[model samples]
Target chain A: MSIPDTTLASAKALVAPVLDDTSRAQIRAERMSAFVRYTLLITVGFLMLYPLLWLVGASFKTNSEIFGSIGFIPQEPTLDGYRKGWETSTPYTFGRFFWNTFLIILPKTIFTAISCALVAYGFARFEFPYKKLLFASLIATLLLPNVVTRIPQYILFRDLGWLDTYLPLWVPSAFAGDAFFVFMLVQFLRAIPRDMEEAARVDGANSLQTLIYIVVPMLMPALISVALFQFMWTMNDFLGPLIYLSSVQSFPVSLALKLSIDTTEAFDWNRILAMSVLALLPALIVFFMAQRYFIEGISTGGVKG
Target chain B: MARLQIRNLEKTYTNTFKAVHGINLDVADGEFMVLVGPSGCAKSTTLRMIAGLESISGGEVVIGDRVVNRLQPGERGIAMVFQNYALYPHMKVRKNLSFGLRLQRAPKAEIERKTAEVARILEIEPLLDRLPKELSGGQAQRVALGRALIKQPEVFLFDEPLSNLDAKLRASMRVRITDLHKRLKDQGMSSTVIYVTHDQTEAMTMGDRICVMKDGHIMQVADPKTLYDRPANAFVAGFIGSPEMNLIAGRLDGNSFHLGAQSLVLPDELMARLRANSGSVTLGIRPQHLRVNTADGLRAVVAGAEFMGHEVVLHLDVEGERVVAVLPAADYADLDRGTTVTLTPDPGQAHVFDQSGGNISLSTSQ
Candidate 1:
């Protein structure tokens, strides 16, 4: 029939272009489009990275040279900034600040990792009385402004005689005070099929064993994300350490970086910038190493209705 | 190997939505029992309760000599293969198969040997080092079954294990699983299998006894032949066969079954049982049992015909009621649409159900 032939002709006509499209003009147009897209992406990427590039470049410049040029390439590069930055005016060296920061960050990361995972596991896997209400409260805490609770929390800590210690910073993490990580890990946990855990339970594993063997191993990517995030956040936490740590010896690198600038004396711009660059290294290394896990953790699943 | 007993098992979710009513079942040691039903029939829920994956609202689950209602899933001595296979994506096949044994702190060499033995049996030896994601769907299902097999539990619960597979793969896997059950039994391994599926074909092919359920209640439980030959009610009669039994609403008068503009004399035994409460009833006949070209039969018009290679299914209309009849394709090759034909139900194969769907033979109460 003409109807059948006409339908066949139209179908073939629609598909013919894709099958035979390698002409020079088409190739040039495609290449030009791709080239434009890449060029735009690269320009945007460079603009975003310019501040970091400038910081690293200015770290090696003299104080006067840093102000002279906003360009990344320093006129004359020197290690004097590094040398001077490493030696704090305090009797203790910058090594103590680095060590103190680790003391806060390592424990904080471990605590946040364990507490958040446990809380997220509870939220994701089980149905208990008031579970919905409790979870809603947890999410509500995510929306709560940190400044709203800051004064009351400080007063409570002062009442408990924890005024000038890392306890105030790392202790709350033990209770799963960071709701964002708990929420992210919970989403990752919920994405996993319940059958695996059921299989584990049937295989004779207890609740804790199921969590450790079945849930934790599958939750590794999200856990790594939680730890990486907690580490980066605690490392860069200036206000928390500044508020609690009174003694110079107890000061973390965040407080030490701010302490490097004597307002009465010259600003010591190059040394401060050099210390800032040094501070950025750990976070940078961590992010690059486990960035894949961080991205997978947040984007995997759990938003389905 | 153990006899598993579920007495009055019930599951009620929060907000008072009942997924499973009280269900009673006894699965003998080495029995291959299949729970077959449509979606929302609570077949999966019943299987989950038996596996201890779901908490029972009210029931007693006894495995062997133990009342395991309060016991944990691991303590129930059952292993389940889920519909999605539930293979741990991170673990290698060897690790997934050996996880349960390792969890119990089994001897390392024993775990290795058992893992290798199951891998060899399932023909997944080369896949021992590959992750679950690396395996195809069929391969992952084999690994999931291997994980359950290596445990050597008293009972194996399969929740639509082949539903995720393609038709060809599903057929092959069905045979493989049945063969595995036979081999395990022949080897004196006491393996009781309880499988659940929404497909009646799977139930008929794989189950030693099929339990047909609907709306959280079992309609009937019987072997494939008995279920096909004699269903307890209209639901079972209609559900257990493909193209479903043609169930037409009718009235059962003293000695005749009357439809819209058609009537058939009732067989003596059916008439004797159904004469008591002879108001509204459903007359059921399998498509294969409805014969065309009978000397004295109801008149029908051939509405459509489907040529099914060996057989041609002719959709016939009697007055306004649609009835289907299967005829040898070669013999009925010239049957045309809109042609008039005579259709009759084989007297011995017809089924009559009361208004409430209970079979006339079994329900004689007025």
Candidate 2:
């Protein structure tokens, strides 16, 4: 394409009608502020991500290079740390540990979702005796510190011969021991109009059927959020598994990662960082994948009317 | 098909707060009875009691020959279309229509057949695959009606089902529901419908008999024409008509009603009833019954005039009382604000209520 037969002066005039000095100055000022704002934001963003960058860089560096400077670029990158992290100084590999974590997380997440949903449905829909009292107690439990009952629960589990087993980690979820999930699900259930359940009841469905068919399907996003929350929290749990699972063979990734750091001698910092990165991957992937439902579930469930 | 009887139906909350006082109503088989009132009148509560959704505190709900007060909502053989149209948001229209029958363990073919029949009847067959959220308000309402229809229940309950629609859609849907009632009767589906609404227009149009309620008390139960013509009290008179009846407090002296500086000669029958009560009365005159002219009547100042298409409503200040008169637009279109006019109430159409608002002039012969 060729330009139209117009003088450069006319082209300039066409591109911009003349502006008053104050208006031109205002435009310049707006551009300057926008440029400054973007630059500041980008610098702050980099500052916040510096630690994660250092971790990723250090995972591929030798221990000497890692401690050489605060800079994130590795002098020499190698797969040795990943190789060593995959096969730790234990009888079982990280693969087995990942499997162990999954064993605990999958069932715990499922149990939490199912049990909490049923409990929430009961609280939301039914007019049972002491319903308000029970719901109030459930919310009150949300404010109770976990450390308050930790010792008592540990002692009870030990007395039941459930020590060194995943039972201690996942069993409580089957009974909706997580008050937060139950509370969240209850709010979600309440946001659902009573009309749907009433319609179901009029359609000849019993209470259980109404829960399964009407309430549960409408509650899918919230239930998925509950499952995702349980999965991530269970995966990242350190204190619980450390308290119960003493045997190295039964350890989850969170505990196994702790086991690899040798404080008595020179620690394999690179290998530890590599394994840490690997451990975070699953949670990061899960969060990114399900964040839409997580956000929607929270906003929708939190609306009272 | 069954006759429904509510014998002294009462609903008390926490054994103290009486939401619905004891009220008796008999809805014959195939009758469309509308329980209409202002908000907090317990009209919805009354319908729920009949549907077995709300447990009656002190009454018997009998359907056919069986007392159904102890029965569950589903077991009472009633289907309800809720105010919000309560279509399962996640389900397609077909599934919504078929769900009730499916829950009854009906055969798949029968459920399909009935759902198809209802869809055809409602002209929602093309919308069968669409979810509730995808449909318009009117379509969602049709699906709600279809869901209730497919159940083939003995009784139908509508809790202000058209209240959520736009005014135009509401007017059209009102005719649709009335036509549905007629169609059901013609089809030998003698299902009794007990609809609850706060809109007097819906009560006047859709109901075979309108039960007017106030503060949990039954005010009157009559057909639309009777309700409009012979309201039982000032409350019913003011509630039943558009723009409401002009109820002005006055004293009856012989055959004349003395309302401030304005005087009206009371009808002979009403004068007798007023004589018997012998106290201040609320003289009820509907807007259409009041005529505005420059000739012989109570002199008044027209404060404002609103042109409402075919008719004009003039806001008149008569003896310091704000009275409204509906006049034909073609005849009174040029009447300006601040104009002086004489207002005359048609004696035949006037009503006289005693100080307590009871219609003393509703003759016993009627």
Local accuracy of candidate 1 as per-residue lDDT tens digits, A17-113: 8766757668889999999999999999999999999999999999999989879888899988888888867788888999999999999999998
Deviating ranges (above 4 Å) for candidate 1:
A1-49, A68-72, A302-305, B267-277, B362-366
RMSD of each: 5.6, 3.6
Q: Measured against the native two-chain assembly using Cα atoms, what DockQ does each of the candidate structures obtain, in the order listed? A: 0.53, 0.61
Write model 1 residue lDDT over B143-242, tens digit each, in one string.
9999999999999999999999999999999999999999999999978999999998999999999899998888898899989988899999999887
Model 1: what is its DockQ? 0.53
List, residue by residue over B173-271, the lDDT tens digit for candidate 2.
999999998999888986689999999989988999999999899999999999999988999999999998999888877777787877776656566
Evaluated on chain A only, model 1 obtains a TM-score of 0.87
TM-score of each: 0.92, 0.92
- Best model per lDDT: 2
lDDT of every predicted structure (CA atoms)? 0.88, 0.88
**TM-score evaluated only on chain B, model 2:** 0.96
